[model samples]
Target: MIGILAAAALQADAPVEWTALQQDNIQVAELAYDVGIALAVICRDDQLMVAITGLPDPAPGAKFRKLEVNIPGAELQASTWRIQGKATISLAPAVYARRLRTADHLTVRAPAEEGEPARRYELALPSDHLALDQTLEACDVPLVLETDLTYDPTISAVTWATSPRITPPNRLPPGGYAEVVLECTVGARGRPENCRAIREQPANSGFARSALLSIRTGRLGLIDGGPPPVGGVFRTRLTINVVN
Candidate 1:
């Protein structure tokens, strides 16, 4: 019984032979060999993740070892590295949650060393351009964000029209001036329809009315999807010219 127990202890402390991994965008910084091998990685915390290239054997299943990552250029302060699955076994690649936006951004805050201010840097992560659960065939798959946008419209022509009416002032002093507001409906077709004076001036309102009639009438453009403009109001200032 004593011999059997001693042999079991040695078996438990044996190291499993493995090959060095060549993952794109990831570099293996250090490796420690003990009862089991431990790997240290230097990679971007945002978007950069890890994955197991080779699978375990068909029989019992390959065991997941523990993995560690060191963020260089950071002050050695009291900090803890968080790992998913809460398992000490070899660390797996960092899993990212699905985000429905233009791009993903992460800001890491590390204690500033002696002179450098508390260092804070932003990292832009690759977006999941493909749909969820999309299988990737390539060993090195590049994740990209898909953006669908519409183009802007170009103006073919533009024209402005003015009214031909005089506005009356409230307290028409010797030669005071005032402006009246004219309400017109400009449709998407670019035609000025229902042209009329919604507001009135004091006595010389006729002059203001004539000024509004000077505007030209025409179709602006094809209104296939655009809604026609309704109840549009425009302000026009008219000088009061009373006949002598």
Candidate 2:
């Protein structure tokens, strides 16, 4: 992790300017740049974040209040905040890793108010896969492995606020059993977000939906000690076994 932190620090100091837009286009948005580590490593807490500096504050009641980001294999939305004269978007670590690994370009669209036109900006990705790999490894970051996640007692102890109710779908035959797996990020506050099904035994079963709902609404207990949970990957497995 120290190596990753160092690399990220270097990147932060001299980020590559990826793209810039005219003031008229984005209401003072200047440029989108890349710091070597796609996800910003918060050295103080070892949390992962993605920040895009240089955007104007949004108007009240804007249609696209959140920023829309798209890469080759993923489409993500992030909430923005005005800090130090720039608009910034924070991305989940898991999401950032998934998209940045193979993405060649990043496209971002800003939300517009009732009468304002939406602005779009695109950024080219750096072509250093080896460095990126090392960076990810140094951070001990896991690849987006949906079905292969092992249970982490520390994460589970704090995150498992309530037991998820897994109901066997009516579509299943007698004595049927299925396994559902989900991948999610637990923030510093221990709240889960970006929950999605990594694997479901039976296609079209409601198990995945139920699991997602439970994760989102469940309360997370506070975690103490090393690194804030921000962007920490959490996976849960639910096996529904029907009785005769």
Top lDDT model = 2
For model 2, the run of ten residues with the poorest summed lDDT = 21-30
Per-prediction TM-score, please? Answer: 0.21, 0.42
Q: lDDT for each of the candidates?
A: 0.31, 0.48
RMSD of each: 27.3, 13.2
lDDT of 2 by residue, 111-197 (tens): 675577877666666555444443345445665565323322122223255445455565773457776777778764566789888
Clashing residue pairs in all predictions, respectively, total 21, 0
Model 2, residue 150: displacement in angstroms? 18
lDDT of 1 by residue, 6-41 (tens): 232233333322223335643322222332222222
Stretches of candidate 2 above 4 Å error? Answer: 1-44, 59-65, 72-87, 129-135, 143-244
Q: What TM-score would you give candidate 1 relative to the actual structure?
A: 0.21
Off by over 4 Å in 1: 1-178, 217-244
Error of 2 at 95 (Å): 2.1
